[model samples]
Target: MIPLARRAAIGAVLVGSIAAGVLPAGAAQARPLTPATDREVTFTVDGTVTYGTLHLPVHRRGQRMPAVLLLPGSGSTDRNGDQPPALTPHTLAKLADALARDGVASLRFDKYGSGRTGLGAYADKPETIDYPAFVRQADAAYRLLARQPEVDRRAVRLIGHSEGALTALMVAVAAEPRTAGVGLLQPLAERFLDVLARQLHEQLAAAVAAGQMSPEEQRAIGRAVDRAVADLRAHRPIDTSAMPAALAALFQGLGGPSRRYVESIDAVDPASVARRLPPRTPALLTCGTIDPQVPCDTTTPLATALARAHTAGPGRVVLPGVGHDLTDPADPDVLAPAALDALHRFMRCGAPAAR
Candidate 1:
């Protein structure tokens, strides 16, 4: 299992009446490309120059085309779903390629600490970066996508992976002109801290089973984590002085530059957010059986929430052998065909239903 600290760092819905099913092996082929152009774009958010790429289908002219705003997942991930110096899955970029081929436009940007949009005004005071700041950036991106002359404002959709999924939900719930739908890919079905706590517990348990940590040591760390979680949730300062070295380092990192951001995200209940989605809001929830970060079983609450809300689209799809990045486990460099198929179907069928 990946370490707690490392795993902690990395962390959409859509429309229509498509049925959920798994694509057969080798079914990852895409339709022939429509000529498209990629342009570098920039937008301002809270005085920061946010950088992004806008993908437009060239063949479709004189008609507004469907569009999507791709939100990157947690930790230093960039506009193209890559974390430099190591990870380079290119999930979002591939999705943009697929969407353009399908005659759909897309916009993906570098958020705060990543890519060309690095830090910006927050260079001196990184602590000022919080969940709301990310939301504002995404909202700005969505607005830019909607305003583009080539996009149909009413046909714009939001697709986010992992932590970005929460941001997408918040934006979709409050979007003006009413967002057409959302695609929540590899989403968190619970509060941020709750998910963190559960992950820590599982890690600790595994450590004990492996004999790397004694049962007593595991219990001690678990207790410390519980206290720290309570402090974060209550908006109180975390006192990590008494924690084990590993636990202390983890909590200190969370409580330092990103404390406010961590707390803000912790306070959000994803299920509750799902409940607030506008009536008939189309949603597509997906999880991968091979995704260790957000295992398929943990998605129940989010699926349940969407069900109660009466949202449209193919509900909660569980993909086989796919990972959190929506790539096949064996080939992390390429996007999974089944995942792509789901997204294409959603975008194709997500036109706003007649009132």
Candidate 2:
């Protein structure tokens, strides 16, 4: 599931110190360090105009460059991998620049409810939007990227972060033009609700042990959460009357306008999706050891699935002391060099001989 502002709220309720930090101005709004030409592009999906920034490498005469479709994580994250005012890592934008330096083109887009896309046709009916809606939007973007005259249609890849990684798997599984490769960074590895449940249980348990929440209260909240999950999976209404205020609000967020999306994503086990990838697909999976949202261990099953399917590339590269954004925790401005290096190697674009 996409990280949302509500996650901080829930964290505060369950664990007071789990607050999100705001990046300094320099880090939040820094221009791309590497030079690349950027084109603002738009495509229609479900009558919604999707806005994106296509970063193209300097043209080499008679050369059709490899390309990638960059997918941002969940929540209100924009095409640049920023959830404005609080989180502004600009992960995808920097990634595009990196790809440009490697003689590869990349397209990063704003999905519905994000950036310039802003709900569009679903402005008043956001509830109608679900997981498939995002998949459709991404599929359209992939098709658009592949059709670019300067792009090598056969060399187009998909690279996604967090929730976007799961979307990439789904899109690659059914790509029409066929995907050259896939890169998953801090991916969602389990069923969405299962991960949510485990997180809530751990936090609630810790709160009880810390004397922040009573054991009785923890039991009550757990029951309420279980009930809500059941209702969501069964396609019934969630009843939050028995839940505490904070828990109630969180469930309401999960079950209201985003309910359909929650249910749809929850139905998918990412490892299962990985198993369906076409045999021998080039794939790269990476996880940060200190990433609280997606623990490295949780990605083991996904890595195993990909390996069993005979997918190629470095199966899983574990970066120590890195956070969910693939950055050093102490310095959010710079993405971890190891992560970037792994990506560069996977794309196989930076070498002069390759160009």
Candidate 3:
């Protein structure tokens, strides 16, 4: 219920708002969204290939519209950004629907090394599992978005959540001479090790508080994290690739090592990226305090960094009671109203002229 709104002419963005996620509420009826012609397509990057679904208005293509490239977080979650258990599902799809209602268009696809490739695509995958790889895919998506003829090549934006946000920033950074703007939600700010350490600690503490994690198990995790952080500091990948003795199998068997996944997570430094962007490109970053995933504290640092360095043009925050999915305090079937509101504002408002 905590709403944060700020307006600035730092660029052309009219209104920017954000709020932290809070406790969940009861579920509600699911409203069926109007059917749009969904097209399944594929693209290539560095000799590798991936697929995606394009959701466009049923109308003919003429005027280009602002678009968002939606990316899911870690793990095998598909393009819709669906995860397991009680945590919100269908978040990305809902967001896309909302944007479409406001005259905006969006394109989202499954992460590479999966889907088309199949059978542990990760192992056969190239270094695109790393930062450079993601940047290239996003650039390819941009070309696809811009070439749609119905898309306003200059008005496109990125709406990345969780690990996707990092990928988005990299996309935007490398796309400096191309993208229009970027909208970040629940992006991880701490170094990979720091956030992992914190998450593991919190989980362990919660288990201890609930009498689940044995004292020995908790101690082992702590030892593992300490070692991992040290290795990362020494310039190692800090993921399964480098943490061979500990989480190697967990990461390798799952797919690529976690290190390759977050390879350049630190490269997501919003402060510096903001400054490098053309004065015309705007940036919006947000996260929730109550989020079970990304911490709310991370958002402010990015905002402050952008503002202090004068990098986040038209940047702001939104605090709604939910998690990384931006679910509402009152409904599971629907994302909080604020998430819808932010999408509307981002799409309706004009983007900073392409840098």
Q: Which candidate number maximizes lDDT?
A: 2
Whichever of 1 and 2 has more lDDT, that candidate is 2
TM-score order, best first, reads 1, 2, 3
- State the RMSD for candidate 2: 14.9
For candidate 3, what is the TM-score?
A: 0.74
Across 1-355, the per-residue lDDT of candidate 3 in tens digits comes to 1112343343224221111123233211132333456778778766656778777754433445677788766555567876444443876788788777766678887776444423223465444366566667767876777677667666778878777776676677656336667777777655555676678678777877899867877777667667666655565544443343535454344233545455465445655554455544567676765786677775666676556644434576666665677878777778788777665565545564322
> Across residues 126-238, which tens digit of lDDT does each residue of candidate 1 receive?
99888889999999999999888878787889999998898999998888657888889998777888888999999999989999989998888888899999998787889
Report every candidate's CA lDDT: 0.84, 0.86, 0.63
In candidate 2, stretches whose alpha carbon ends up further than 4 angstroms from where it belongs are 1-35, 349-355
C-alpha RMSD between model 1 and the true structure:
11.4
Runs in model 1 with CA error above 4 Å? Answer: 1-34, 352-355
TM-score of each: 0.87, 0.86, 0.74
For model 2, state the Cα shift of residue 58 in Å: 2.5
Q: Give a tens-digit lDDT track for model 2, residues 251-337.
A: 889988899899998999999999999887889999998887899889999999999878888678888888888875667777788
Better of 1 and 2 by TM-score: 1
lDDT of 1: 0.84
Sort every candidate by lDDT, greatest first: 2, 1, 3
Lowest summed lDDT across 10 adjacent residues in model 1 is found at 11-20
